[model samples]
Target: MTSEVSRRDFLKASAAGAGFVLTFRIAGGATSAAEAAGAWEPNTVFTIDPSGIITVHITKAEMGQGVGTALAQIVAEELEADWRDIRIDYPTSDPKYGLMLTGGSWSVNWTFDALSRAGAGARHLLIEAAAKHMNEPASECIAEGNRVRHLPSGKFLTYGDIVSKGLITATLSDEELKKIQLKKPAEYKVIGKWIQRLDVPEKTNGRAKFGIDRFLPGMVYAKVIYPPTRTGSKVVSVDDSEARKVKGYISTVREGDIVAVVAENYLAAVAAQGKMRVTWDKGPHANVTTDSITQDYWNKAKNDTSAPSWVDVGDADGALAKSMKTHEAAFWTDYVGHAPLEPMNCVARYQDGTFDFFSGSQFQTRAMGDLSKLFGVKPEQIRVHQQYLGGGFGRRLEPDVMLEAGLIAKAVGKPVKLIRSREDDIARDFYRSCTLQVLKGGIDSSGAVIAWKNTLVCAYPGERYGGLDKQGRDQFSLNGSDHYYDIPNQFVRAIRAETGMEVGYVRAVAPNYTFFAVETFVD
Candidate 1:
């Protein structure tokens, strides 16, 4: 359903809730007073410069999920404009507007307000800009296409013409951010319609540029010698003297974490890399033999009393002891990957004033912050260009991949294009956190649950509530909501233990794991 929140009209919108490469922005937390008044944190930079062309900055990077197009449709609808004659651009990856991250399925959800606000605000300003040309009050004007109309006279002034006179330069206040009117669902035109994706043409016509295709004049080549395994490994030593003797081989470099090649050309880079040899300090997981992350999850699930408790309804112990039968189940899940076909790679350059970076990240703000922290530069100097992800099944947040490119660029003092091997991708993803749900439910002969006891252990990393971390967003809460099937007694206790690997959010998060355990227990 739609609201006065035209996807384009700017909304000081914030999601109090939780997309396509299949994600939505994680939209919930304690609601603040500004939020209660419908103010969302502004993340987009919408401006139509001195020229007539609209240069709206999109916050979400395209990952073949249609976010770029979907987000624009909302804005155009509010601009009451046609896509055939519009220009949209993504934010430079930096914190000025925000880094363009295409993760968390938040492309659409996150922009609800910002887009709505951007659209309504833009159109409002455009109308105001138009009204100023006509010496008419903005209230007397309504916009149609690029023209703002005076209802009484039925005459109109074109936005382009108004711009020819002068573009509006007003800024938004806290009150304006909250005060803008939004479009209701009944009136939505461009959004929620079967709008075609904009990236399709570039992809079809071969005009599209991916990270691997990023190149400029005098760009040399590189090849990374990946560690043997994913979790913990290191480069023990390297002998590159032989490579140095080869033609086209320039020089080699090594730092704290990585060691690799630098050459004059692509084939030279390849030949040089092939000639070099390296010894690695492999990790324990080097012997990783099975799809079974099952054991690790279960062992960690045992019992951690300090685990956050999300649900408790009745006296679970007493009910279970008093019940006729108890049903117990421990669900074991397999570790999964964000296995997008594109794998992982990044393009980086350290110039005089800025560290220019290009990669796929789910959190642009976080990525920029991470790089700034690493380089000891002001966040403003670093520019992150959020690009289309070939496919990001949640694998984009590994920041290590982006970091590798950044590190190499900083080390060499030249722009570097970094691409991870497929094996590099598979072996090194912040994989989906598989879990073991140890559940105990008591039931009477009447098929009524007398008590429910569920102990949960986080297999993945978690989200922050009020900037504080909690067990993977509690899934048991959904079941505990009503015990859904009228379970008279229930106690859902969760135990969270730290996984050795860095675990973070994956699709469906807690609800999927919790529901699998919950629905099975009910059945």
Candidate 2:
């Protein structure tokens, strides 16, 4: 069966307003990495009807990440249940589940314990209920292959028949709960064993529906109008009269101040949008060039001193002055964007005041909450179907695509599939933020770095961390120092650029720029 989470429902769950509580609990005894779903909670997985199917709601988004299958293994391994009879689905946009996303290689490692425990708890309840139905002592019953079998009579009951309304009606006492034994690593039949991906066959054969391929019953395709600049600029005037004259074009709507939504066939939409003449406010950034941006970084790094302390080994200042020699250098890196092959696309529909989104994303929960706030709806009302992403590398996780799709759909009253062309994607994209850095260091006679400091001495500043106050905001460093080797006394500092474009995540985040400064400068 397909997933039930709609786009609007997902957005709501993400924000976590209303009475929606996404509780998580760990089971009694299971060894796995911590799940992203906060503290673990039992009773996380439940069946809809007994004897129908076993469903586990996992938090991780699957973008060829193998999160769907791995999470099932967590459940089946712990429950010692039948793997063939189970199906895994995405959780609702609940605060508990929505924020629990699968990215940054944090999938199996994150949900291992919480999901296993949820499975183990469900497994135990099924076993106990089956034992009671068979008129046998639970002590004499063994749970295996979704059946709780009585040793003496070989009597058994399937999980479906054992559970009512998918609820664990038979609650184990605290003592009974403590006595519950989870499968050990040695007893594992599902996890820690070689297994094929469940969705790979469908994917390899072209049967899997990617986010770009998703469509609603009656959906119109739309294209975005991207200006050659960043967000927050105002649209002075847009002349869509010429665009409306195109053959396949239906209409052009000003979805956002700087965005125009054009609905038509692929070639027709491009032909139509190309004809539009738009004028902007030509804000302050209009005159700013990339060269000027890098220049700002140089000045900031030269004066930065407020770098946060990541680690401290010894007296870094004193050793640097006494060192046999000191060295310093400057470095620069050009900005880059993720530019995934599939680009960005979303299928959105709003009916009965609820939003439904079908897109590929790393943050299913975050999507719901962000949308709820954007649309002024309850989080639970948004349903998100996190389709298989073509490629993320962290790009599709942004709110821009999902929000725009929803707005276009809401405007048209028909489900709309919005996408970006290769050119449009790049022009409206965010990059790794170009940087210029200067490093200064001192090495002792023994050839060890004693004191090291690097500043964002370039045209632009680094991440504008919300935690820092206004005075502390502009001064930025991609990251603090990481002196891997032993240094008797060493420290690094951050200096912010006085001006430039906003800085954001690129690939490995701040570490890339920071590492270059420390490693290259220390020598």
Q: Please report the candidate that would top lDDT against the real structure.
A: 2
**Over the stretch 360-392, how does candidate 1's per-residue lDDT look in tens digits?**
666565566566766677777767776667776
lDDT of 2 by residue, 1-523 (tens): 0113443453353343221222323333322222221212245453323453666666566666677888778777877667777776665455554345544465665455545555666667767667777778988998788777999999877665554323234554545544556667887788878878777888889988788888678788777776645744678888888888888787777765735545656677778778888888766677677667765565456544564444445766676678899877778877777788788888889899999888887666557666787788888777887677787766765657778888888887888888888887776665666667656678777776677654454323222212343344332233535546666665544444433344445545344766776676654
After superposition, candidate 2 runs with Cα above 4 Å error = 1-52, 96-98, 164-168, 172-183, 305-315, 456-480, 497-503, 506-510, 516-523
